[model samples]
Structures are given as C-alpha cells and as structure tokens.
Target: MDQPAIPRPRGRPRRFNPEAAVATAQRLFHARGYDAVSVADITAALGINPPSFYAAFGSKAGLYKQVLERYAHTGVVPFRELLRSDRPVADALAELLEQAARLYAADPETTGCLVLEGTRCIDAEAREAARNFHLAKEEALRGFIAARHPEAAGRLTSFVSTTMAGLSAMARNGYGLERLLASAEVASCAIREVLSTSEEHPS
Candidate 1:
C-alpha cells in the first residue's frame, strides 16, 4: 500500500485565528494601555503577522473593543444572579468583592477589569458605550431589588452599586488582597448598617 499523503500547504487558512488573537489582544491591552500598545506588539504576542492580526481583529480600536466587551460580560450574568439571590444584597455584594479580589490576586495581569481600562483612551463613541454600560448595570441592579424588595429598591440599588463601583475601581488600582478585603468589609458593614436603619425606619 502507498504511504498516506501529507496535506499540502494552503495559501490562506480556512479558519481565521480569532480565538488566539483575541485572547492575545485582550492580554496585551491589559498589559499596556490601548494607545501605548502597537500593532506590532499584538502581532508579537499572538505570533502572527500584522496582516493576519488585521484580518482577525479588523483594527486596533476594534480589537480593543472586542476584548473590553468580553471582559465586561465575563461574570455579569452570574453576578446578576447574585443580585437576585436571597442571601441579602449586602452579603451578595460582599461575596462579589471577595470573588473580584481573588480574581485580581490570581492573575492581576489578565484580571484588571478591561471596561475600566478601556475608558482611559477611547473616543466619544467608546465613552458613550461605557456610560451606557454603567447605566445598564445600575438599572439591572435596580430591577433586581425592585423584583425582590419593591419598597426599598431605589435607595438600595443606588448605594450598593456605588459601593461596588468604588471597590471595583479600588481593586483595579492595584490594591493588595488584604486591602481589598478590608475595603469589602467596610462596604459590607455599611450595607448592613444601612439595611438595619432602613428596616428600623420604614417610610
């Protein structure tokens, strides 16, 4: 019998290398600011040429947006579930802060929240997207409370989400795990106190 034939080299790939490239883009953008990261830097990280990178990600801005979008959506759904959980909103927020701290501690390089980083160098359109994203997060949180505790929805959503926003930003600013936990603890305590106050004084 004749030996099995070897596959011939195809001029172009049948499948675009988006997965590896996109992951690489995300990593690079997190490592270097978007404006600071050159296309060559991305190509080197991905081990692809500029043409291939462009083919896979379109443009630098486009690639950054895709990466940022992925990072933003990572735990959002599960996080929403936590918001709707019966564990008490304050406890749920505490859990989220712990998770965020662990995530950053595990790999500070890949785990810096991209949406926060992306806002630094983007144009008006991208800034608008970020604003809309925060608005949606706030709204989802409000709906979560409204569905479960209609009477206290407005105040709880505003305060808890604000605390979370501050903690998230603090974590991104390179706070140590201990510092992060302490910050979360403070937020949790405040949440609990506010809840106790609200319960005591029903309006």
Candidate 2:
C-alpha cells in the first residue's frame, strides 16, 4: 500500500522577501491608490498567498505604512539637501517647487506623489498613515523657512505645501511635465515675491 502524501503548509514562499514585497506593494498602491489595492491584489502581484501576506504584513494598512516609508526614503524629494543654508532662501525654495513638479510627473505608471495621494485614501488607517508623513514634511518646510524668514514662515510653508498638493493632483490626472513645470514656475515667482515683500517690510 502506498503511504498518503502530506500537503505542504500554506504560507510565504521560501524565497519570499519582505522588502521586495513592500516594493511591489508600493507600486500597486502608487498606481491604484490605497483604497483600490486590496490585500489579494497585493498578494497576487507578489506571487504570494493570503496567509503569506497576512504573516508578512499584519494588515493592508500595515503594509501601506512600510510602503510609505520606502517611498519617503527612496522616491521623495530630498528636501534636506535642496533647502541648504548656503543657498539663498528664495532660490532654494523655488528649486524645491520646481523639483517637485519634475518628480510628480516622472513616472507615467506611478504618477503623483505617493504620500500626497495616500492622504486622500478612503481607509482611515491608511489615510492617517499618509497624513503623518505629509505633516512631517510640512513641519520640515516650516522649519527651513523659519530659520531665515521667521515672520513669513507659516504663510510661505502653507503656500508651498498647497502648491505641491495641487501639482501632485494634476500629475495624477495626466498632466505632463511641461505643464507642471510651468505651474511651478508661477509658484516660484509667487514665493520670490513673498520673500521680497517680507524683506522690505521687515515685520
């Protein structure tokens, strides 16, 4: 009599890499947004089973949090480097906006800022996760502006953040790089004007 064969346990594949899974999930989430990409979709994309997905990432939101971190580290604009103290505030800030315009439209498949798009996701947990990154970036912008132009820091930071949000949304809507760059140029002009006015008024 033949012995009965035991079935293999259901779980992540032996070669499964959590970091690679996060990168794959980042692509799906970036292309489709958080609400649109389900756990099954992620698993399928990563060639894993539901059990494996759950074992690797506690939930969809948990995976999204990791994706967000990866995007922040690898995909996001290097604000710290761009907002250097050596450069004039207006010039550096203008360059930041211009760089954002370029970045937002860099990828046709993964258009727009990932963290910005995540902020509008339907899931509360995912939305909050994205908002945290957005808030942190805003704080960094405020800090950079406050260092040189304390009086206009809040207003300038708000203006830049709002403009970047608009750029991200436009990029998601299929706006090309040239159009975004034009819009960013207008924003740059506005920033320069604000800084000039602040210096003249000195209050």
Candidate 3:
C-alpha cells in the first residue's frame, strides 16, 4: 500500500544572508536612525522571523552594532589617509573637509555620518559605541596637528570636528552637494586663517 503523502513545509523559508542582513540593516539604520528601527522591522526586511533574527544577530542592538561596524568602514570619508599625506596641514585639512562634504551627501537617503547620528541614539550602549569612533578620529587629528602646530592642535581639531557635524546635519536636512561644498570651502578658509595666525604667534 502507498504511504500517506508527506506534508509540504509552511510559508516561504527564511531567505537572507547574514552578511547581506547587516548591509540591509545599515541602510535602515542610516536612513531612519537606530531607535527608529525595530527588531520587527529588521526581521521583516531580512525576510526572517523573530527567532531567525535572534539567531543571526542576538538582538536589535547587536544588529545595530554590526551595522555600525560595516558603516564605519564604508560610509565615512577616509580622513586617515589625507591626514597622513606630506601635504601642509592646512591643505590636507581642506581636502578632508571637501571629502567629508562629498561623503555626507553621497546618498540623499542616508545623508550624514552614521557615527554622528548614532551619538544621538536613545540607547546608551549604542551612544558609547559611536562615541568611541568619534573620539578616535578627533585624537588622530589632534596628534597630526600637534606634531606640527602643538598650540593650535586642540583648537583646530575641535574646529574640524564641529564643522564635520554641521556638514552632516546639513546633508541630512536636504542641502544639495553645491551647498555643502560651499560650506566646506568656507571651513577651508577658516583653516587657512587659523594656520596663518598660528604661524604668526608660534607658541
């Protein structure tokens, strides 16, 4: 006698790549911010259920941290390279700001630096996560400047960091590329003046 027919599996099987999931989460987090996107939202985006999501990332925060890691690598401008160049500090910094403007406005949907936006996230752990990277960039700039203009190092580093935040905010606020570039040009001029005065005082 023929055996009873076996039952077919239920709805669509979970179809998502763990690596691809991180990228998808990155887009969502970048566009909507961390607190705004829910575990359910990620699960839906990844085409997986809550159980699968937990298995893959542990939690929403865990996924966000992973996304942050990916974004930190790919999303921001590579200032470290510019800072390392033998070019004069003022010139390197001007290029750095110009690159920042381009990166921040590269995508209208995900305008702004991911880490900067994460600093405002509701979760304390996430905020600390972002802060670590932010502070590292600041320290790198400070060291580069201190090597040449020690007196102006702290002040100029602060200036660059503040200007970067403003650029990110403007990009997110729908400022076009031209406008962002204009802002960066003004910042570059400020950098030149700062360097000029630092050279004049030499203390």
Candidate 4:
C-alpha cells in the first residue's frame, strides 16, 4: 500500500518586503486618497495575504503614517532649500510659489499634493500626520522671513500656507499650469506688498 501524502499550508508564500510595500502603498495612496484605499487593496496589489499585510504594517493607519513620512521627505516642495536661499525675501517667495505651481500641476492624472490632501482626510491620526509636514513648512518659512523681516513672519507664513493650499486645490480640480502660474503671480504680488509694507511700518 502507498503512504498518504501530507497536505501543504493554504495561504500564499510570504515574500513581503516592507520597503517595497511602502513604495507600492505610496503610489496607491497618492493616486487615490488615504480613505479610499484599504488593506485588502494593498495586499492584493502586493501579492500578499491579509495576515501578511497586518503583520508587516500593523494597521492601515500605521502604513499610512509611513507613507506620509515618505511623501513628505520625497514628494513635496524642497522648502528648506528654497526658503533658505540667499535671494531677497520677495524674490525667493515668488520663486517658491511659482515652483509650487509647477509641481502641483506636474502630473495631470495624479494632481495636487499628498500632504495637502491628507489635511482633509477623515482619519484624525492621518490628518495629524499630514499637519506635521505642513507645520514644518510653516516653521521653515517663519525662520526665513524672520531672518529678513521679523515682524511679518507669522502673517507671511500664513499667507504662504494659504496660497499653497489654493494651488493644490486648483491642480486637483484639473486646472492647468498656466492658470496656476497666474495665481502664483498674484500671490507673489501680495508677498511683495506685505514685505514692502513691513519695511515701511517698522513696528
């Protein structure tokens, strides 16, 4: 008589790479907002099982936090370099907004900024994850402006943040680069006015 064969385990073989998984998740989250994506979607895309996904990421929010960090470090504007430049405050700010318009409209299919979109995410933890990047940007802007015009740093940072939000929103709404550039030009004028007025007031 022949011996009975032993049955093998059911689920797919585990070959998940956390870094590669993060990169894949980053794309899915960027293409579709955080709330829109699910663990099942990620697992399916990465060719892994549900248990493997949970074991690798802990939870959806956990993976999202990692994705947000990756996006902040790599995707968003290079604010530290741009804001800390040797150019005049008004000129630097104008360049900053102009650069933002270019980036926001770079890809028509995947428009808008990942960090900015996260601000409106329904998940509280996700929202905070995004806000941290925005706050860091504002702080960088504050430091740059304070070096030149100490009195106007707060207001100027607020203005820059608002303009960035608007630019991202317009890009997501299908606005082209030309329109975004026009908006950026108007914002640049406002920046000039603020700095010029601060110089005059000296309060």
User: Lowest-scoring 10 consecutive residues by lDDT in candidate 2?
Assistant: 194-203
Please, what are the lDDT tens digits per residue for candidate 2 over residues 64-120? 999999998899989989987777888988899899999999999999999999999
**Residue-by-residue lDDT tens digits, candidate 1, 59-150:** 77778667767767553324665665456665776676666556654566654455554555556655555566667777877776566456
What stretches of model 3 exceed 4 Å from their correct place?
1-15, 200-203
lDDT of each: 0.65, 0.90, 0.87, 0.86
Tens-place lDDT digits, model 3, residues 38-98: 8888888888889889877887878878987897678877877898736689999999999
Regions more than 4 Å wrong, model 2: 1-13, 200-203
By TM-score, the candidates rank as: 2, 3, 4, 1
Output the lDDT of residue 71, model 1: 64
How close to the true structure is residue 144 of candidate 4, measured as C-alpha lDDT? Answer: 85
Q: On a 0 to 100 scale, what is the lDDT of residue 155 in model 4?
A: 92
Model 1 local distance difference test score? 0.65
Error of 1 at 59 (Å): 1.5
Q: Give per-residue lDDT, candidate 3, residue 52.
A: 85
- Writing each residue's lDDT as its tens digit, candidate 4 over 56-88 gives 789888999898878777778888778754768
Report the alpha-carbon TM-score of model 2 versus the true structure.
0.91
